[model samples]
Target: MDDTPTTTRPPRWLNDHEMRAWLGYRRMRALLDLQLARRLAADQGLSEPDYDVLTSLSDAEDHRIRLSELADRMLWSKSRLSHHVTRMQQRGLVTRQECASDGRGAFIVLTNHGMATLHAAAPDHVAAVREHFIDLLTEDQLRILGDLTDTVLAHLREQPA
Candidate 1:
């Protein structure tokens, strides 16, 4: 028997409108993330990941949460979260305590310094958002964009990696 690769059907490509929309979305996302990170770093001495981790901890009860739960909430890999946590710990922004019930696990607790930093950073972050994003959109546009975001996010979540 011959062992040969068989040809499949041609790939489905995005048409003009779809292509424009997809590319535009990609560009906007990339630029927005870059700008946000830059502004945060310049104005508050915080990176985007720092802000995310800090905010997650701040929102948790007692400003403390398990490391695994934080990783899941941040949508970050274990290794990624670990490294960031270590860096933040060095900066006096957070502390990790061994879990009493789980010897192998730990909890991330936001420190007073972290809370102070977040409180200082939040207003500037909000202003940046308004300047760069929210102010540019009308109320109707904001509502439609929000709905579109939710729809796309839900659909993406249903797909396999």
Candidate 2:
């Protein structure tokens, strides 16, 4: 081992094999996202964020959920959710309500227009998902992936930033 005084900074280390694996993961994810985004944009005029909100609302009871809950589900900060919601509200896609239980608590309510948009978007979104991602994976692979992702997500959630 040559004792060249390396800088005090910790070296960022990854073996050649590890680096290739990581690069492959990143490239596939980016490419898939790009393809999905383009398909959605062309077919439904839904941005990824817009689709996220729509899907979150669609999965909630009565197609409505609390604003903070929506933010959590979208993995978005409250301010970012607020800004997006404000724009959606302007488009008559959603509305906000003061929670009856808590004066400070607010709920994000999906309007009829929002539901309509989601319905219209669903087919193309599924087709895109199937074509670009799902169709490539076996059912077993999909299940294993879901399990692995959930495990990783749990670990990340437990770590303090």
Candidate 3:
């Protein structure tokens, strides 16, 4: 404390209005995430992470992606994804296949059952998302949200990795 120096030319901090807005956004985001998780858990017996993996597989070119690539896309650590995949494979929701092109690389391929479950859950999941978030917002608000998210993502991407 004795060695610390105070600066008069510091960066501008968020003002009262900005603070309120930022906090409101944070609270709403947290609540909405909880609501979505609860809804999905109750309706489909799937956790958010479970649904994320299933949905990613459903959208992939052939319901499959390389294990490492899947982990990267999901922003999960390799060990975590591997363990999750192992559990899912045991559940018969997905299977691992050796990559012919690369002996070290394996693919997490979603089974037909997994695809079916995701397909069945999609409508309900989307409806819940809409009811809880999108339906309440006006088109302009949605556009602004999209823009805000894009801006934030871009800014985050610019940071040192």
Candidate 4:
């Protein structure tokens, strides 16, 4: 082994303002997610993942999307999406159809029941979001938040997987 001495650089720590902003953002994200999840479960008998999948499928052409594509869009692993899809299939919310052109590929299709569930949940979810988060922000704050999130997301997307 070579005997080159490595010099370690110290991390640039967050200052008070940055620390406060970071911590506040973390806390807000956690609480907002929890509140939204609770409201979805209590009002619609839907978990966040369930709602997410349903909404995604609902937005797709013919209410169907390729499994792999859906998994990528949802940021879920193939195995996890398969398991969740199995559960959704059991509940009659979704069904999988074998792709005609590719034997190994399948499409996730939203059933009528799933669409109905999403329709029922949308109004209450929007109300809850407005009440808990959106209503708390001024117009300028909302615009800034949107810009901030967009910038962060763009940076993250550029990084290696």
Residues 1-161 of candidate 2: C-alpha lDDT, one tens digit per residue: 99998779878899999999789889999999999899888988878998899888888898889888888888889899999999999988889999999998788888999999989989989998999889999999999989989998999999985
Lowest summed lDDT over 10 consecutive residues: which window, candidate 3? 1-10
| lDDT digits (tens) for residues 1-161 of candidate 3 | 59887668877899999999999999999999999999888988777888899988888889899988889888898899999998888878899999999999998899988888788778989999999999999999999999999999999889885
Residue 43 error for model 1, in Å?
Answer: 0.7
Instruction: For residues 29-118, write the lDDT of model 1, one tens digit per residue.
Output: 899888889899999999999999899988999999999999988888878899999999999999999999999899999999999999
RMSD of 3: 2.6
lDDT of 4 by residue, 6-121 (tens): 89999999999999999999999999999999999999999999999999999999999999999999899988999999999999999999999999999999999999999999
Q: Who wins the lDDT comparison?
A: 4
Give model 2 RMSD, 1 decimal.
4.4
TM-score of 3: 0.89
lDDT of 3 at 138: 100
Assess each prediction's global lDDT (C-alpha) against the native: 0.94, 0.89, 0.90, 0.96
lDDT of 4 at 88: 94
Off by over 4 Å in 2: 1-12
After TM-score superposition, what is the CA distance of residue 94 in candidate 1 from its true location, in Å? 0.4
How are the candidates ranked when ordered by lDDT, highest leading? 4, 1, 3, 2
State how far residue 88 of model 3 sits from its true place (Å): 1.5
Candidate 3: list runs displaced more than 4 Å: 1-11
Model 2 alpha-carbon miss at residue 91, Å: 1.4
